[model samples]
Target chain A: MSETKVFGMTPTWRRDVHTHYCPGCTHGVAHRLVCEAIDELGIRDEAIGIAPVGCAVLIHQYMDLDFIEAAHGRAPAVAYGIKAVRPDKIVFTYQGDGDLASIGMGEIVHAVNRAWPLTVVFINNAIYGMTGGQMAPTTLLGQKATTCLSGRTAEANGYPVRMCELLATLEGPAYIERVALSKPQHILKAKAAIKKAFENQVNNKGFSFIEVLSTCPTNWGLRPVEACQWLEENMIPYYPLGVFKDFE
Target chain B: MAKGRVEVREEFCKSCGLCVAACPKKVLRISDSINPRGYRPAEQFQDGCIACGICARTCPDVVLTVYRIDE
Candidate 1:
């Protein structure tokens, strides 16, 4: 039998570096999907990436692209400035839950509300991964973190922000979608959604926001596979998945 | 007896078992031998593989590579 390689090691955007993520963390999967989308759309050369403070603060080490590290929770503002000046480049930002929904909330809201033609890849792992499992603004109720040892309660913690729904309420964004990296089928769909977001910017559609529900096994206190199962069982229900809003 | 072949980049494997769970053919398993990084890597434990690329797709570490075989 002759074997034809359907999938292999090289995705042009992926650099040759050891991934430092935890055993079960899906950040690598999320990175791969993002790379695949860029490869398909042929935007690697013109793509400019903005990474804010968090686990992926040094994301440029893994992916071979021009990257800028923004102030904590301020990637969206930086991205907007870059896009405004260099309208020819495809500007995008990769942000984490705490950075995007918490500290950078105002930056993101205003950027999307202003309708900047930028692609935002938001990774929501619920808890703050790099800072030692602290509760994030998107952390679900009943989930325990170092900051909230007992569990997140509505009275004490307030509520998890549904970013897609929140941003969809505004009339600025051209597209808003939430997808998970828990399953292979879902990963495929995630790749498509992300590709579409890049396409939107390439076609000069409008601001595109793609929320990725990811896993943090070490921080979540679960095995890698178990954390994925937990995401499917717990996170997906509250976060939900699908295109919350799309322009045409 | 297999219609597809799979290979795992063991050095990069994080021993997460995501590929094992994602494989529909049940061909991959965590190997007993640990890699240089001290984590057990995934291996092809059986013969019935359809090479659907699910393992590669689900791998969080970008470890698995799938190939379709033509006789």
Candidate 2:
């Protein structure tokens, strides 16, 4: 209790609990951003978060707000259902790459195409972190995972899918951005993007999606610091961070 | 005399060392004490801290609580 206690002591949006995320895993960073965005916007009371499959499936345990657990890759659909009936409440989906880009791809496309007034936090860590590091739809080409021990090959594994770019091409989205959590500066920007996504809904600005390039150090087989460096070095180049579309 | 200070909830820290790396002032170091989780938590170095909160923001686990010290 000193210095008048100006800042930093666990935001009110999240419960003060020990998280299950691996040490240095960017899912921790991404989770805090979501929680902070909700608290910062003062929408915690009316916000409903839909978390689908992957590592964040149990995020409901961490966040204090109401959460709807959707089937893997079906968070968009769940978000749509909630927003459709209770339009007054803010609805968002926190999903991983495998859930958002692969299995639940159709749900997301349809929800965006329909212009659902929802905020989507897409955590893209490339490899499938929850299932022993399998190759995900967003897995970087030449990146190695348990499923691709020798590195992902073009002929065998195809190519990485850019979610922000793909969704930007759609006619319905109000905002689309791809941000990363590699450093403090980038995390600050990511926080801004997430807050903006929620703000868009509060202002009735149609659909918003933020694709966060996160790190999975435990699965990636790298130290936490090295994984962050790896993301900045490799993922940033291919994913190309920035706003793909604005809230126009 | 530091302008700001940080308090680490040691039990919650995973000893990932991200905070140590992110600290621009080099004021944090992984401690020798091992928690029940078997990881060394970071400790604040003596003085020289600007209370920039970069270490707090960069932490994956919400373990660090940064505060600005008054006069």
Candidate 3:
């Protein structure tokens, strides 16, 4: 039964662009949440996105808003500049774990410390999806990656970096939340968190950071379903989902 | 009475089966047929659809759109 009234379609802010993300990759889900938040806020015309150097490096192709490509892990710093000049516009950065939690760590820390008015969507997929499944800073202890073929050990590889927990300790950010895309219920929570992060910027609040625990089926070397199940069973326990901090 | 139905844009579907797993009403299934892109697209059973849009929301590829008819 084909119906006529459209209850839901892809968000308009998302260009009619086919994503290159591997099947079952949650990056597309994250992309939809960002686009949906922009559409709901009616900020499509005024919204600007900072694309990072990761699996979502080609984010500009999927999102229809004005975008500037940032170097590896420097999206927050780039967004800082954009927000300072175009204070009237909505600015956001979309970054992946490899780019955000590793090389861009200092930049993100500084931006949050300064309380820049911008939205940051951090995708924490545990492994570096773009660079052929390399271990990322957010990779859980004992998680296997190309670099850590025998599983990450605390003795040699150090510990997984919990970005939300680290940033919430700072006094600058007004909102900080971590959500996941492993299930339908989790997806709804993620959307709400994403929207709140965007709303913080709209309300002239300080930095709003939403760290999304996403899945990397290709990198994780698992079927799409298995990847999501693995995320629920493994990732959620370490990176618990919740609002780390919210001033408002 | 069915409240809503899903339209699968076959060309874009990666056949990840997330929608099938997500449908609370259990109305979706991966078709035996494969798309030109070499992936199986989800097909709706059209029987118990409440049009909750959960399947569409859960879709990573934006391959499915939920449409509801006026009662």
Best by DockQ: 1
Candidate 1, superposed: residue stretches over 4 Å from native: A13-15
Clash list (residue pairs), candidate 3: none
Model 3: residues with Cα > 4 Å off, grouped in runs: A1-6, A13-15
Share of true Cα-Cα contacts across chains kept by each model: 0.87, 0.69, 0.67
Per-residue lDDT tens digits for candidate 2, residues A1-248, read 44745346545435457888889988888888888888888888899989779999888888888999999899988888898899999999999998999999999998999997899999999989888899999999889899999999999989999888998999999999999999999999999999999999999999999999999998889999999999999999999999999966
True contacts kept of 2: 0.69
Residue by residue across A111-158, what tens digits does model 3's lDDT show? Answer: 999997889999999999998999999899999999999999999999
Cα DockQ of the candidate 1 complex: 0.84
Candidate 1, residues A65-116, lDDT tens digits: the string is 7898899999999998898899999999999999999999999999999997
Per-candidate iRMSD: 1.0, 2.0, 2.7
Ranking by DockQ: 1, 2, 3
Provide the lowest-lDDT 10-residue window in model 2 chain A: A4-13
In the order shown, the candidates' DockQ scores are 0.84, 0.67, 0.60
Provide backbone clash counts, one per model.
Answer: 0, 1, 0
In angstroms, the error of model 2 at A38 is 1.1
Error of 2 at A84 (Å): 1.1
lDDT of each: 0.90, 0.89, 0.89
In model 3, what is the error at residue A241, expressed in angstroms? 0.7
Candidate 3 positional error at B12, Å:
0.3
